[model samples]
Target: MAKNDGKVIAQNKKANHDYFIEETFEAGLVLQGTEIKSIRAGRVNLKDSFATIRQGEAYINNMHISPYEQGNRFNHEPTRARKLLLHRKQIDKLIGESKQAGYSIVPLKVYIKNGFAKVLIGLGKGKKKYDKREDLKQKQAKRDMDRAIKDR
Candidate 1:
């Protein structure tokens, strides 16, 4: 297996806007043959995907890995629940944090690290309406500042 080299395939941009990420963990994905092919083709979506600890294992829900085009008979399902490989200690930590109020395990991005498929999962707390507005305001301010600097 190759080590993680930070080649991102798909990312959920809304994950940062919707939650305040407290911590992130890199977990390996257990993908079927066609699934990995689809991922390499950049036909994957992390939007609306989340991870859950079930029976002491981590599984990602709603992750969409499009079926390989050339594989007719053996195509994998697009949105099947996929298992995430993590250490026992990490799984236990995720379970504890996810059980807390307003906290969740959300998939942030999917990337090829080494030769394997990996998912970057975040332990996040949901943002309030006000929090979202505040973020927007800050972003706008930063953009305005950059523009002003450029025009100077």
Candidate 2:
């Protein structure tokens, strides 16, 4: 992935640890010039960021794009909601799935891909407390097995 001039700027590792992702989609962010510059400088935060389908379009909320240092009054708002560019069909599908049961759209990662700011959105279901405990046990068991094999 290095040769593509695409650097992963930020990742929401908590999303993965808390939810069972059912699907993922790559989305193009509609960003202002200053926002783009700030993102390229690795000043974006995905924590507490989530996506929602509104008026037949997907929007990302609560993602923070720090202001461009040299930007003046035209600088974009730091926590203003941003629109996500996704296909109409994809948006409809997301809306349908999200409305059913316990599904949600979460921002999984933000990266500069091919000179553009892109985000990976995940469709996920929240995990229960017991599920979280099970996940921890599984991780520990895997680590123990790996260590035992390495020492043999």
Candidate 3:
């Protein structure tokens, strides 16, 4: 069983465009029954979701997992702060790095690994306007080069 063999549930594409990810960590999620069902059904949104280290623990905020239609009164909230299960050392390291200027803990993606829901979190630095522009320019240049090569 190779890593990354599990199905990807959702991704935060905006995180890549808005932040320069310095380091990434995989953390388990503390999910409810309905939340797990919704995630398994691919009804998760990583957009605008971010992770924060609080009181020596990690919690993800703004993560939206749609309620299971059949859940009825047992349905979980669409957007709720969820706990992230991580080692104490990892949490401490994340806390130390996050306290630095312009650094943040952002949720990059979510997936099901070995029947367990997991999240990929990143230690990121916010990108400036010029940084984003430069990235776009470089991407365009790479695309043009690839097109030229394919045309030959």
Candidate 4:
């Protein structure tokens, strides 16, 4: 898959290890005032964030955008359930896929594009323990091969 556009703020690296990402979509975020500033300063975390379609609308939860240091009492909450702007058809597709057993909507990464904060959401299926182990083994083997080639 291609990389996300613009300056990437945060990424959930564990998502790939814990689940198999079947599809990805770039969705805009509905951010408050200081939230956008925090995002521009790279103070966002997507580690435990997930997406859900509620009442036919997409929302992201557990994504943390640190409050701006200089903000007053109106600073946005650090971890709030933010709305994700997605097309109706895309939301429908995600709803259908996520309804299947062991499937979920995971937030993969956050980035800024055209001065807008965008999130990359993925449709992922839970991975078995053996699957994770196999992926680790494959990664280690690739690393070893690359090292061997370098030393040759």
Local distance difference test, each candidate: 0.90, 0.89, 0.90, 0.92
Query: Quick one: ranking by lDDT, best first?
Result: 4, 3, 1, 2
Better of 1 and 2 by TM-score: 1
**lDDT per residue as tens, model 2, 1-152:** 11223689999999988999988888899998799999988999999999998888899999999999999988889999899998887888899899988899999888888788988898999999899999999999999999999999
Give lDDT for model 4.
Answer: 0.92
In model 4, the clashing pairs are: none
Q: Any runs in candidate 4 off by more than 4 Å, and if so which?
A: 1-3
Encode model 4's per-residue lDDT on 1-152: one tens digit a residue.
33576888898999999999999999999988899999999999988888888999999999989999999999999999999998898999999999999999999888988889899999999999999999999999999999999999
Clashes of 3: 0
Task: Provide TM-scores for the models.
Answer: 0.96, 0.92, 0.96, 0.97
Off by over 4 Å in 2: 1-5
lDDT of 3 by residue, 35-70 (tens): 999999999998888898778889999999998988
Model 4 residue 101 distance off true place after TM-score fit, in angstroms: 0.3
lDDT of 1 by residue, 1-152 (tens): 12346789998999999999998889999988888989999999988888888889999999988889899897888999999999898899898899999999999888987788888888999999999999999999999999999999
